[model samples]
Target: MARFNHNKHHSSTTKLVFLISCAGLLGAALIADFLWASSSSAAPAYLSIASSWALEKSGILVVQNVTHNIAHHKREDVKDRKERIPERFLPATFADLPAPELQWEEMPSAPVPRLDGAAIQIKNLLYVFAGYGTLDYVHSHVDIYNFTSNTWGGRFDMPKEMGHSHLGVVTDGRYIYVVSGQYGPQCRGPTARTFVLDTETKKWRSMLPLPAPRYAPATQLWRGRLHVMGGSKENRHTPGLEHWSIAVKDGKALEKQWRTETPIPRGGPHRACVVVNDQLFVIGGQEGDFMAKPGSPIFKCSRRLEVVYADVYMLDDEKKWKVLPPMPKPNSHIECAWVIVNNSIIITGGTTEKHPVNKRMILVGEVFKFHLDSLTWSVIGKLPFRVKTTLAGFWDGWLYFTSGQRDRGPDNPQPRKVIGDMWRTKLRL
Candidate 1:
């Protein structure tokens, strides 16, 4: 054991001596290098250059472009980084925001002039139904205009030829549903007709009848349900105070049941009620008749003050109704086209407030837009022609303005030359 311990000590001594020897050799080599460098410092600088030139002649060393190399590297680094986007590609400034572009085109005329009717498009076909027709008479005929062929081909006559029948008609791409409307020229009490037409078979059937017959009410399809609201209770044009809805399971599978949604707080008559982006918006209509009542022949522009509504009401997330910002102008005698162009809810053309002294009415042909993001309304543009009491629908970024009664200058009630003129406006993209 003692011998083994001595051998281990001897091995350690050997390793230590070898390390010291290696360090001494490295120090000697470094000293020699220093001496050589010191000697070369005294040599002519041109000798080093001459050696480089000789190497280049022999092609052993190559000359580099130092300036060009540095610049190229810097350029590559900048190239790899992102470039600032061009002005044309940059985010839109206030001045660069899109301006409204509207154009109107006349198409083939309807066989009969329609007022206070509904226009719904199924596929490429447009169906125009019940309204006061020729001679201010009420009639029932489903006029079908096909845009695909650019012609009026087929027709469906209503079972009972009654006019002013329904305030609105809605479709779920397959079936067109017509609800209660006025009966005759007098625009008397509403009818109980819940007419459903099948576009596929070109046949009509009755769904469950409207609980109470009423006309001029705003009706639309919301979340697969038929939503009806804010229309005349009396054929004399009293706006109803309540709103209602019935579930339509699919496009055509409507449950024969009605459910109360919410009572409108104000302005039921002549308001445009529409569902855009799942939000319900009702805008601009007559609030109350000024010094007017039943059994009176001159039911307009009385000595008493009138109330035209500029208020806007909206239905919300919790199945409740509330007021959004009011419209800027007071407009009554509603019946104009409300169209949704992408994110903008556009209301165009309506009868305006009556003059205070002259009692002459104003007709509005201006267009207003409600932007969903900003939650505000602004005037985008005006219609090319002053028109009102029109039926409108949007398809493929185009707004189809159907037959509507035009505004006559300074007349008490615009004389009924309800037009059969068809015009189309499309946003230029």
Candidate 2:
């Protein structure tokens, strides 16, 4: 009986050694499978069924052997992995939602012809103030679109022509504020002019000027103050992060104050900015003179790409700038087409570098909706028209944008013709 037992033990040892050898060979194949799967080289050929089965068998073997031999080690590895990840790496917005499900509805038209100005939404009314039109400079032109009525009407013209305004218009739920629009002989340049129009009075009053001149920047309401971001100054490029705050009485501007807050790390003209829950987001604009430092001539279009930044930036509660993941592709010339839906942002069409470079710029009608929580972007349906450098607003489950310039440029030797067309979009999510 002792002899038989000894032989049996030896046989069992031999079987164990043979299994270990097979496991090692399978492990090598498994490693090769992972490497090949993750390769960035030219696309790899599809794995054969036999090879796939072999890989699966090897994975099972490895997992089973590790589970049996190093259960404690696996537990420690998971713990270490959890500890190593930064909190920010986890989903921040919408608690890591996948994508936003939203719908859009179209609006009728804006009452007047305005371009390169600013837009603000108050209650059921959208007030577009002080923009250029078929005429070179028309300041003090205020057009109001009523959401409830699907109509447009307001003070048609101001005393002065406001030209090349920063589009830095904002609202406090009542009056619409227009600040630092260009006027006078330098209608095409920046101006320190500012104004506020009372919805009740339907009249415009000159308010304090901006500390510096700005043209076609972005403005929003945050922390009970109207915050403006990004635009150009007179004869100088302003990729500004300088934040200005204006005090408002129940959405009515009563006084103004300016603060040179953190400048945008990356700045450009015609960028689109919007705020969601007090967090400011800036996206899509022409990268002008951003590379220029003091004493150096600005390089306007150096690092040109077909599309540039699909990335979105967030200025969170900490007042620190965080680079969220970028969009799938970079786009520019996105005016104010940014709108919020289901806590996410919808970024519509803008001119790509291909457009300006090839002189084939179109008013893009495509929409890219970004999910704040999931850090993902999905391409929604396209708009009916190619709208760029236009004013867009969201109200009553619909989007309204108007007064963008569309032109036959160097192609026809004809100067750019500013468009006075208004478009409404309805998203079906």
Candidate 3:
């Protein structure tokens, strides 16, 4: 140690104070940086394929920015970041797709970006109807894509906006029928009324209301009539099991009816239904509400792989629900990717929630092929990205999909997003 003089001691004290202050400032800045980075990572953005088409062997498509959740990120302070964080799935990838087999085409620019609706192919035209868009309900806006001209040109106004997340839609060669949708930001509730549009007249009309008023149900054309099944009538904490049917004639309403065909032995959440060979089958959903119910929840995050259906039911044999062989994968939000390929029901890209015992939402595998006749499921292939199983459908041998609420186990009710990324899985079968 060295001795210090009074004058020297005073000078040293001043220098030490200055150094301490500088260190404090630098520490504060580092903490601020950490907080900012954590918040930025949580912000969610809208992702969609503006237009998807096949290239020589790979799939090429233009992706667009639709909507995001920057506001939700600002609510948390530095400490709150640990408990609650937003999700940003950016810098998307398409490398998961098989190379030298399927590809996508580049689009110029989209006039408007939308998602969570139905696309009906009429003659050479593709008509899009009510769906949850980047904004509120995507109503009063009808878009027509002409395959012959290889361009998009027609637009019509809808009477009212019914922002349904996963409702059923079907075209009867003359009119397009949209029925049973949910209306709200969350897309969890149910809508009562049905909307119809005449392709030739370009006019819209209303039809008889559904008895129970369900949304996100699966529907298809069978025997010149429309069949609807599954979907939820209550919140995510509650589950509903019901089926409905409607008959149409000459672009006009003929009859409307609802029936409780078969109550699922053990009702599940987010049930998926599809039709093949004049027979409709219901598959994969949660067994009970994990958040409110007093039991282990089945699904956590939506898994990309599908396996082990709880119960498989067929709508035939005296209209009684018959139990077919169970699906290889049990899934929820699955009906949309299902299509009839060569008289067989080809299903794809649905998610399974991990049993709620863990309480987390994750992305799983893609499964397809539930033979209605033989009562079995086979894997076709998987999707490059994880999607809500409910946001897919079959149109003209191509599988089309939209954005929806993906089950993120119990950690978060992750919004799969009401995106406009329209993907078409062009198949040879």
Candidate 4:
């Protein structure tokens, strides 16, 4: 054999430079092949074949490159939600879940018509607490529905004069904790009227008052604590994002020292909030962070701020509020109702904004179900009727909601009926 060109005079550095150049050329070829295969309409087998032959020694590295490419493609797909068909990928309720045998059942009506009430189920009993009545009157009517009997039980009025509608109420089976709500003749409050009812004893007693008066707010119990979130403090216009919490022993409160946690990014006059898997979900809410340039009359005079949000937010265990995917459009459903069941969060009813400036305004009857794991939303179905300002709760296996309002509106010019009928949808989720 001809004498090998083994040049002892060539330093190690020269060898390194030559090796690097060879490696770079190989890398450039691999990249070009990858791009050509990806961009071209026809699939080419040359890249894999060449890579396998040339980079055989660095097979592990080649595998890593493939993995990285896959990960990058997945990230791109995730960013574009429109590319996802949630129904094909996610279950309406639970993952890998079979189709639900769902049915709707009509139940006994409330003795009187009411609206803006809070609904909660303690064991087998569904309680419809204080709400606004006909003639724009505040109601203390407390109605109980027995799922076992499929009938309405004896009606009970509130112990004291119940406040205006949109009060937050949560129960730990034994006690019903009613938080701040509105009252007064002008429908003007955001009152600190806090009351607790011994469900077993049927006795209502005053408990720790709310830190501030809030109206049209939402509350949920997470890990033996009550999380109160979002509502107007002064008026419906002054939406609040502040959140407060207090610990409880079993169902009863253990101590009274309530602490405020990380507030929500935006606040709205009407927002629905709930806790699932230690995450707080706020939906169909709005945020009015507008200010009138410091000293303008709009600022000094406290002019109404108009803002509506179709975005949804979740507060996690780290106390961080994360913005989830927004509604299909930007119209804020002014009075929507939401409930968490199985593997999804479903929001229903509520009309869109009417103002011209809020162009997304559209009366919504579509029910959207958000699959928790996939982080995707699907229009599972629509409401039978356009329902707004309705209270929703989960009892047994049914989602109890409103029927048709017999006209809960103006009785003079047009008789807007109040939907006093109780309807429950049984789900085998």
Q: Tens digit of lDDT per residue, candidate 3, span 112-145? A: 4444455666766766655555533444466776
Write down the worst ten-residue block by lDDT for model 2. Answer: 87-96
lDDT of 4 by residue, 1-429 (tens): 233344544566698999999999999988976776575321323344454455445432222223222322222344444543211111111111122233567767776667666767777677777666743466776788787777777677775645656678877777888888766322444677677777787777776677888776667777778878877776456778888888875445677767888887877656666666667687776554222344443222233445666778887778898888876543343332667788787766554443232232234455667788887876665454555566565667777765223323221111255667877786543
Sorted on TM-score, best first, the list reads: 1, 4, 2, 3
Clashing pairs in 4: 164-182, 405-419, 406-417, 406-418, 407-416, 407-417, 407-418, 408-416, 408-417, 408-418
Which ranges in model 2 have alpha carbons more than 4 Å from their true place? 1-112, 135-139, 159-164, 184-187, 236-238, 246-257, 289-308, 354-362, 407-417
Q: Assess each prediction's global lDDT (C-alpha) against the native.
A: 0.64, 0.58, 0.54, 0.61
Error at 54, model 1, angstroms: 99
> Which one wins by lDDT: 3 or 4?
4
Model 1 ranges off by over 4 Å: 1-103, 161-166, 250-257, 288-306, 332-336, 358-360, 409-416
lDDT preference between candidates 1 and 4, better one: 1
TM-scores of the models, in the given order?
A: 0.67, 0.62, 0.60, 0.64
Tell me how many residue pairs clash in candidate 3. Answer: 52
Per-residue lDDT of candidate 1, residues 195-286 (tens digit): 77778887777677777776667778888788877776654345578778888854444565788877788735667776777887878887
| Runs with alpha carbons beyond 4 Å of true place in candidate 3 | 1-115, 123-125, 134-140, 147-153, 161-163, 187-189, 234-237, 256-272, 286-311, 355-358, 364-367, 372-374, 389-418
Better of 2 and 4 by lDDT: 4
lDDT of 4 at 231: 78
lDDT of 4: 0.61
Residue clash pairs of candidate 1: 164-182, 165-181, 166-181
